[model samples]
Target: MMRNLMRIEIYDTTLRDGTQAENFNISVDDKLRIAQELDTLGVDFIEGGWPGSNPVTIEFFNRIGEIDLKHSKIVAFGSTRHIKNRPEEDANLQALLAAKTPAIIIFGKSWDIHATDALNISLEENLQIIEDSLAYLRPHVEHLFYDAEHFFDGFKNNEEYALKTVASAIAGGAERIVLCDTNGGTLPHEIPPIIKRVKEFVAGLSETVGLGIHPHNDSDSAVANALMAASSGVEQIQGTMNGFGERCGNANLTSIIPALVFKMGFDCGVKEHISRLYGCSRLVTELANLPHNHYQPYVGKSAFAHKGGIHVSAVKRNPLTYEHIAPELVGNSRRILLSDQAGRANILFKAKEWGIHIRPDDPILPAIIKELKELENLGYQYEAAEASFELIMRKLLGLRRNYFSFQGFRVTDNKYRMDKPPLTEATIRLSVGGVEVHTAAGGDGPVNALDSAIRKALIRFYPILEEMELVDFKVRVLSGEYGTEAKVRVLIESRDGEESWGTVGVSVNIIEASWQALIDSITYKLMKEEKK
Candidate 1:
């Protein structure tokens, strides 16, 4: 598709609407960090929060006000004036003014159901609320945007009343009249025509106002709906970072911005900073301590991951054969995933990417492939355990270090009474630089005990191991057919002060699997230090 010449304004409401998500939470400091990131990404506007809603929100506006954003205009969000109060007297309107932002977005009911059933107000009163609320704030702020909440549903139900609400906002001086999919159930096919009708309706009134789209992801079509709106000539697109919001989410700007620029050919403010999208997406989820969706469309971990042999070979020859857009265009890199499904092509690509020199005819290539396939047959997965895969590569390439040799290890768990917690202990004997070391440690569990004992045994030779800490441990039963005797795969994430890596192990015995993963974790850490 050809790129559209028209520019679209990007507005992020992550601070306000994003916080409505159940699992997502951030501090005032976090909010400031995110705002700076959004500005760096070249978003047109950032809705800081409603100042009068809470103490944290007010503090957010005050603290963020001190930052000199490079491009984004900070916007404060709130609702229209109360039905019973004048615009000047409304607390929400007063809070929007208190935020002291250059732009403010206020939403009012457009759905007749929300007006009558939710707000218990007449349709006429709602229109007055929309008109007066915007008119009062129009002169106070540099830019005033009005959001018609539940606009799509309202238009479908009562076309006249919905058009009237938008007209009233335009009459009262809303620079941009945003149509919102508040219920988030509107389909993509339903958007363009409605926007066209809206444009025609405004044309008949002999008035023109900026058009905007704010969609939620309840039906999993927010991205599609947003694109439809843009194609229909909307100037502004409102969404949250990583689609964070109350229910499903606000439209995912992370996905939308790139799509608009690359796929749909729409010019957006974020076009220059498009390469930072992946890092920006991760930053938000990281701050919220939420697991990033690995399969998310644009900014996911596996967005460009290749597993099948045919795909790997084809992608190596021509990435366009498998990928829609270049991964680097969005700050993401292609991943040659190592697993049972991987082919020789996958290995070659991974070897080159990881800076491991290898020839297509190298004898070790076949050996490594055989070993990986054998391991996978035994229920080991190397995709998420890159450290383990790296170790295998080093071993096959003769780059491995013999930091320590394990002699033996034993772990015991004792629980004599129901009232008493189990006591776990581990003993390890190993040789470092030909020096035999014996260590014993106690922990909350057997894995922890073994980890402590092994670290105690090796800390003498590789003192740098002291800087390494285990961050996460995950165990999965590879097969449930055998139930208690099923093979288990263990992945251990380890990190030093600077870097992190994951190691994998598989065994029928859980303790053995954990032990294997732990050993690889330490080995990778030591190897990295030695190389430096």
Candidate 2:
């Protein structure tokens, strides 16, 4: 496969659809930060949002113009006229023009179902609507593109009508006609011929129009469909950086761009900054406050990870036999996971990562991993959280730290006066490394009581534990089958004095799980402090 010789436009719409995800929200400052990053990533276009639809976006472009993007052209996305007014006079058009960007991409319905039902307009009127919209935009900017949304389904129902829509956009002075799989239901096999037909359709028109694609993932083939379009001669691809959009989302440019350049040997989007791919994916997810999807293809945490014995053995011998590509090519590291099925190689590999040396067949390693796996089966999952996993491994390896000497402590949760609010009472019997033996008490809930008790038990030896604070605590219901007694798991993230660690615990009792995590948090804090 030949790499694309020409510099292809890298358009990113992460800020628009990426934030639409549930539990995902980023402020305008965050969006602009992302836009600035896109500029760093060498994106040619950054589709901000529909200014007419929301005030946040309206305020976004207002300040976005102030930031100097070295390689990015600001683009605003909008839809066709609102059915009643002429496109030229539409308020949406006024909003588009107010953006003051070099390019404007507008979507108009192409699916027969949408044309009649959603728009409540006739088939011919929809085409005319598209024409009016583009005609309205064409003179406003030299770079105008039309998105023929749901083009695949539209083509399937009325091939000529769909092709005619693209033809009409060309006639309306759209420099590019992007055929969109709006519903995201198109399959990989169905894309080639459809894209081919559209390519031939444009070629016949003898217009210097660029062919483009935008696909959704209702069928999990958005990436494949987009690639199929590219293979069939589409020059431009519009997608969100992390496959973000309504419903199942859009093509994942994070995965597609790298796969296109490294695996398929094509050029698009910051081809040389390959190492930033995973970092970019993570940053966007972080900004959105969305937990990174572990199984997301190519750039996800599990993309090059291996666990099963057979797979690990094979991969250790020949990575190409299993891995699609070297992880480092896309700025991701390969990981080997340990579970019941994990082999000695898996444990040894992980140990090596943290600069701990251990033989694969060491007398104690297999036993340690087996015990760890059993603990995991009992409700502890460390695979997704590495810091806590490493802590467990270190403990099993007899690497222990004694930063402070603790006496004894008692914890009580209020079940009377504050029965609903979870009040806690705790007391500690004390000592430190034989220093200022001072003991004061404080607490909020059961976990807090335990934490305060432990801190009081140790402040005499090491005073830094007082500086440690629990930043976040997450509780996971492991199963519902246990009925009222279902096993629960907890992950505690603690930070203090410029250091952080994650601790995990599991038990049938929810409070017990949190208590176990509290113990680990205190222990980890002590160990790290002592080592320092």
Candidate 3:
């Protein structure tokens, strides 16, 4: 006997609904790039945007029309015919046609209140709006999807009217009736029974009309609701990448797609390409200039990271003992965090993974372990400074070069007037290959000045250092009791075009901490080049 695999459609609205998120906006080029990425990820549909909303949306539709998307159909989004206008005369409806996409998705009011108050039209007139809008686009497009706005609340308040709204859409040849939780407050447990009732009601309307779900994340139940909806036999699941949308956000497809395929035994079409999930999620967040939610499930940096001693040891011995699934299954790698809680197992695993061969009984292992603990006690966190950790490991293994020796450096800050910003300057003296070098430079701040001076002094011996740049710097106070005199830990992130690395230093002096971190950053860069 064969199992029946549920075939689910993934309709992504990252380009449309995602941009509605506060502090989350993408350019036209960003939209095109995301469309191509979704196509490569095997999404069934990509809702471009509301073509008639603004110039940005119109430009997205115009530009995307020129590209040939591989797997996903470009969907132009819009609203139903206005109460005061005909379908052809409505600007929104005409813009959907102008988009020239293979599919069109238009939303209309389903709730009696939204129709009577929001659209300021009679409830009966709203039904005509849904029917006429879908009917007008049905003949022109290969697929037509009608979104029932505020669908769940509509069903709860006026079940008969919501059913009638979906019936009108089906009557006008809508291929799919998408139930939208526009406010995103619907509970997960409420989904299954509600969908069951809708299925029973729609059965009498049309046998071929499919059901889809569009949920927001206001109450953080959007993902749960979407999964429940899919399990309850909704043919289509609509969401945005990384859950970026209005209010809290839309359903996070990064989380949903994996759950549906790996856990629930559903066929979401992207099972083969699901390994790209992490990269896809990060790319969207990166393009939007938003910090990736490190705590996000499935794709977050901390998702599979083990921090406790017992957990790390168990994960090292048998990953499945502590992990729900192999991190690689979602294109993410398992990370055993090294900190105060780290045991010998953590060091052993990290050494082997970094390609530094070390036996369980290696003499240097004990020394490295002792040094790591001492450093961590001083508030040096290696978890975020893996490059520094790796460099220390390599040094213990005798595989690291001296690179260059730091001598001394001085930084000065001066401000002549209250309105004037402080001017920072630094002078560095260092030895490279037994040659003495001295350099001076100015920067916006003390750290930047120190970094410039160091780079100037070392660039002659190691010309490759010119390619490296400090991308991020963060400072944290380990002990706040001292206030201005508190011990600080500095973590510096550097990128050398091909890859990025993090290094750390801790001290009571902020400048000294920064200088230590900067030195380690350069040393790690040299070490990586040597290994390569």
Candidate 4:
């Protein structure tokens, strides 16, 4: 007997439903860029925003035609005709046609309460609008899809009425009828049986129509429900990148695509480009200006990271012993995190990565691990400050060269007027190649003044320091018992046009902590330049 294999459709709504998330807003150009990325990733459909909603979405539809998409079809999303207006006179329906997309998807009320309470229309009239709206757009578009909004809830409350609405969609002319878990309350176990009944109902009407699923992540089961629907024979799966959507989120296509391709053996258009999954997920988060979830499956920084001694040793021998899939399959790499829990295996791995030579029985290896543990106990973290850790290793091996020496620094904050801000000034004395230099500068804050003073003192000696810039600075208090006098940790991120590096320091005084991190940052930049 031949095995059953399904060709699943990958429909992405990141530009539409994804924007409904709070603080997740993008401009028209951002949407175009994301759409192009989705097209390049080989998604089957890219649902553009509702053309009737706002001027930005309207401009998107108008301008999107300029880009040539290779693998994806542009889809315009909207709602069914209003009960008060005819199908031809409805503004929402008219805008969908005006968008000129090859595919269109419109949603209608399926739950009885939504029709009676939300729409303020009888259940029978609600069915009429669903049929008439799709019937009107069916002849105009190459592919027409109907979304039975709140479909799972509708089936649970009034199964008969929900089926009536679905029947009306088939009576009209929908190529695909997508059942939606709009409120996202439905669990995974509830999906297959409900879809089975719908399949039977559709079979009774016509055998040509296909089924699709749109699930949200309110219950954190959106991906599970979508997978269940696919196993139960739904032809299309609708979701967004990184699970971004209204309320909690939509189904995460990043996780679902790999599951379908590798675990379930389903064919999808994006299967050939699956290695771009991590980059695609990260690009969406970067464009949104949101922090990436390091714990997110398949694409997060910590997803494939090994920290424990036993785990690292096992993985170094055979990755399948600890990992579910190869991280490279999804454009991600394995990370060996350095911490108090790390052992000799972790040290050797990082040594090789940094091109530092050390044997498995080298005497300096144990010393490095001991110093690392002591620093971590003092609240020093090397995970984000690999430059500091690398410097430590090079110094232990007598391979590091000192570019400059720090003598002393002074910072003062003075406020003269009540309404005006305080004036901060920093003075630094340092020596480069046995030559002494002293400088002073004013800035918006104490750290800024100190940074300015140090740069002023060093730039003339090491002209390359002019290209180095501080990109980000973060501080964390290690203890709260002393409150204002607590020990603090500072992390400084610096970039010099080619790459960025992080350095860290810990001290009881915030300025001292910042100064330590600043020195490490400069040292790392100088070392990188010397290597180049």
Q: Encode model 2's per-residue lDDT on 142-201: one tens digit a residue.
A: 588888988889999989788878877887788888888888888999988888888888
In the order shown, what is each candidate's alpha-carbon RMSD?
Answer: 1.6, 3.2, 1.7, 1.8
**Which candidate's lDDT is highest?**
4
TM-score result, candidate 1: 0.97
- Model 4: lDDT to the true structure: 0.93
Q: Is candidate 1 or candidate 2 better by lDDT?
A: 1
lDDT of 4 by residue, 464-514 (tens): 999999988999999654888789999999998898899999999899999
lDDT (Cα) of model 2: 0.79
Candidate 3, residues 1-532: lDDT per residue as tens digits?
1233879999999988999999997888888898898898899999998887888888988888788887899999889988889888988889889999999999999899999999899989999989988898998999999998999999999999999998999998998999999999899999999999999988987888889999999999999999999889999999999999988999999999988888887887788899988888998999999999988889999999988878888887789898887889888988888887787889988888889888988888778889899989888999889999988888777788898888899999999788999999999989988999988999989999999999999888889999999999999998654888889999999998899889999999999999999999999888788888
Sort the predicted structures by lDDT, highest score first. Answer: 4, 1, 3, 2
Task: Provide the lDDT at 432 for model 3.
Answer: 86
Off by over 4 Å in 3: 1-4, 397-399
Q: List lDDT for all candidates, in order.
A: 0.91, 0.79, 0.90, 0.93
| Model 2 stretches astray by more than 4 angstroms | 1-8, 309-318, 359-362, 366-381, 384-398, 405-408, 415-420, 434-444, 456-472, 476-488, 495-500, 529-532
